[model samples]
Target: MKPTLNEQLRQNIRFTYNEALELIVAMGMAACGEQMYAMAQDYKIEMDPMADSFYEDTKARLSPHTFRELQFFFGHNFLHKTLDFGFYVSICSNPEPQSADDWIRSLEAVPAEWMLTEMVFGVYHDKLEELLQGRDWEASKGNLSLLAALVRDTPPHQEVIHTQEPLLECLAHPEECKLRYMQLLSQFYKDVFIRWKEPLKERSEQASAHYETLFAAKPEQFIREIHKNEPEIFISFPAAFHVSQASQVGNHFLNFTTAAGNVGWVIFGIHNERVFGPAADREQTELFLKAFSDKRRLDFVLLLKERPHYGQEIASALGITPAAVNYHSNFLFFLDLISVKREDHRMYYHLNVERLRELLALTAKVMLD
Candidate 1:
């Protein structure tokens, strides 16, 4: 018999531990690389094969340094990509499935580009719902403002507004107006914008200080620097770099020499987070760093980790009210950290244990030291 979805996912995780890590890292860095590429594309910035060439040349010249930067870049990028994809998968795969084929088909059908777009829309929808429910939009106005700025920066936003002006004008009431505008606006920018843009923007703002510390002239320089400074660090390469040479070829060399083990690759590019299993292995390295952070809400994760328990069981275990647990659990489930199994009258929770273990190990190594 074929493996169950959970079982299959576990096997995949175990089988490709290094690859999975690589994918997570790749996903994270790609989030930045892709975002930069999109922005460059929008500005018609002459597509330099140099970035790819530089990356390769640097890797070859300074493999160590390039590796470390790649790893840092990947870690930073993975978390955002994972959470974004996780949320998208959760919403798209509603009303949990009973058969493996149904679930597999569901996974296969997820359009990565659309998934990212919908996730942005979902965030806007939730914010609008919150505003409608008496929450203050002004309190979170900074975020709203940023969203607006992101829309303005991307060319697609202008196109979306031009095309969707009618829809925006139709929902002109105060309660719905902002959201409608954001919804329409996000649609246009989604293709060009990545979830990691916010973090990258923050990083870019502090570029002069952080760049020398984080990025390398070559891959070997990255590895050697990490060996001298942060000996425990693990780094991975982006698939794009494997194909480019914008950096000095030697600078891009990777040093996987740490006694604690080195970074891994996720391989695939942007993908749907909900599509769990070996197939989802490509470019998922971004998840390792993002999921490791405390921002992921531990209680929900604990509930999922414990067992395939029902709502009340999860609530009781976490020492919270059922309604609260339901809200949080739903969010975690939405994030793809947990899965729901409905049996007749109730739903049970199952955590993605293998992924959890991988994340935990990486986090312990990176942060604990």
Candidate 2:
């Protein structure tokens, strides 16, 4: 018989920190300055005050031009949340780069064409040939309209840029686009690296000690309890899991990379107050009820019940925007009501039947026990 999800987690999950991962978070947040600031301010009750402070301080140090470029490259609707960048970073042979300069070199080694393809097409890059059958990607490599149309129609079930201008410009000079990205990261590093390195190192030590001890003591309990606050952190059953502490991001950020292996990386910025207590049946019941409370979320789950669907398909079926679909999907994902399958780089969502059954049973127990 297959091991239980809890057992799988205990066997596969590990806690550690990588400064390179933290730098990506920092640069991404800094690029997302206003948005990050607003989110931190709005979620201050649950966010670390240092998160906002980190963004503000780092923003003050960068020149206007460099900061704007950063936003264009990594901002949410810009390059579609920088998954292409992060994915490449995670693939570096060296698990942890010794310095910011070393990290830059690793990024430098990424092929210009591959970076451009991944940036524009996202996960579809790997499967473009298969998806298009015999059609050659090279033929349309310079056709911005065609690529944009592909992105528009074949949604990867994640946030993606809708604007065609950035991709259009990049296709004209893929190498330059890549070089400029490296340059901006370098500049961002110079301005902010010194300030961040030590704090991140110290936070890593503190978080590692606290979490590892808790996890070792009760592996099953630790895996189940860390996500007590679904609104803050979400973890699905992954082959391997990584938790990184962030300084500039909001309360929660989740990223997946298949470079070295399938790894689910969840980054949590310093939280001023967080507590993991005994599981509360009432809280679990409330979450179950709340998850189904929204009609859109319910519709999304029901849609997946018919068959696995990508983000754009779900949005089209529900008559909502892709971004809205992503929003609802996150909450469902947090509840583990949906499981993701990646085919050729695109994410497809399937309803988690077992999790659904367990939740219904748990709700019954909570309500009638």
Candidate 3:
């Protein structure tokens, strides 16, 4: 007898995290933290002027080389099938802690061309051969910004013709840039993670335990049980990059990943459904109350509870524009109360019963605690 596709998919899921992975993720997050610099005052997180400039410089060097690279790092499901631009990281293998030295070695081992390809072609990696079948990269430097000049000098431009010279710096030396940036921030990384060591360890432990329970349960119930407010998850496999980072910021979750060899990320957000359960801390409870207080949001939730509906359909049902529905949908999505599933080009939204339940339960627990 043959197993079903879902079984095959479920077999791939694993409960895992590693110190090395966390370190890299932490570095990336730290790099991106400057964007939320203004919000630090709310948490009383000190904002250093010099640190802000440093993060800016770091972002420029580590900037994603391609659109696909950007999508992966931001933890979006956006991907192309030709390259498997988004592969599932937690599916096949469990992650184990790697010493700092081992992590450096792992970084060193990453192929230069592989990193370049991820930045340049990414989802369109399969086309790299055809795109540069016989072009001399060094020779085409003069035509950096002009596709026509490129075609005149190098015939290959006539193939998938276009100009993207700004990204050339990245393609030229991806490995060097990546390593240098990581090295530059090594001291800061060491200091920050060391300071947050205890919390990181606790969160990592909680994540591992939570996943253990989920894996032991039925696959069909996996999404249903994740968080009480989690809308019925209908996302495709290999599309999510789930990172397990223990941070109070990002609501204990954020989207981030760069194509680590054809894989997408799924952010478990440390405060994962299993680990933190449905409990919303003080800050989150305030946010939820404000978001949930709206009459429109209330109607939207009740509507989704009945069945999954696309933005336009939901809007028509609620007597609002699709854009308005989209806005509200995004808020619900951020709260994990709703999820999206693509059918053709349309993204259908449905209630996450688990998230809803968790939100209510946690709201109560938080109030009492």
lDDT of each: 0.36, 0.62, 0.48
Clashing pairs in 2: none
What is candidate 2's lDDT per residue for 145-245, written digit by digit as tens? 56656654554434443334565576567778877888887887788866777876786668667766666676665555454433212234242223444
The local distance difference test score of model 3 is 0.48
Candidate 1 Cα lDDT to native? 0.36
Q: What lDDT score goes with residue 176 in model 1?
A: 45
Q: lDDT tens digits, residues 214-301, model 1?
A: 3333333322332122312332211111111111111122222234433222222111112222222322334444443544357667
Clashes of 2: 0
Q: Which portions of model 2 show Cα errors greater than 4 Å? A: 1-8, 37-46, 77-80, 83-99, 123-159, 224-242, 247-369
Q: Report the alpha-carbon TM-score of model 3 versus the true structure.
A: 0.42
The candidate that wins on lDDT is: 2
Lowest-lDDT window of 10 residues in candidate 1? 241-250
Tens digits of lDDT, candidate 3, 1-369: 876544644654445555555554544445336344544444435544433543454455443543224222322111122111211222212233454445555545556454444334432334544445566543533342332332234322222232234235444545564664345335434545555545555566665676666645654445444422232222233322233543323321112233443232344544344233433255456667878788899999999889988888888888999889878876787677888999879988978999888778767767885
Q: Which runs of model 1 end up more than 4 angstroms from their true locations?
A: 1-306
Ranking by TM-score: 2, 3, 1
Error of 3 at 21 (Å): 1.3
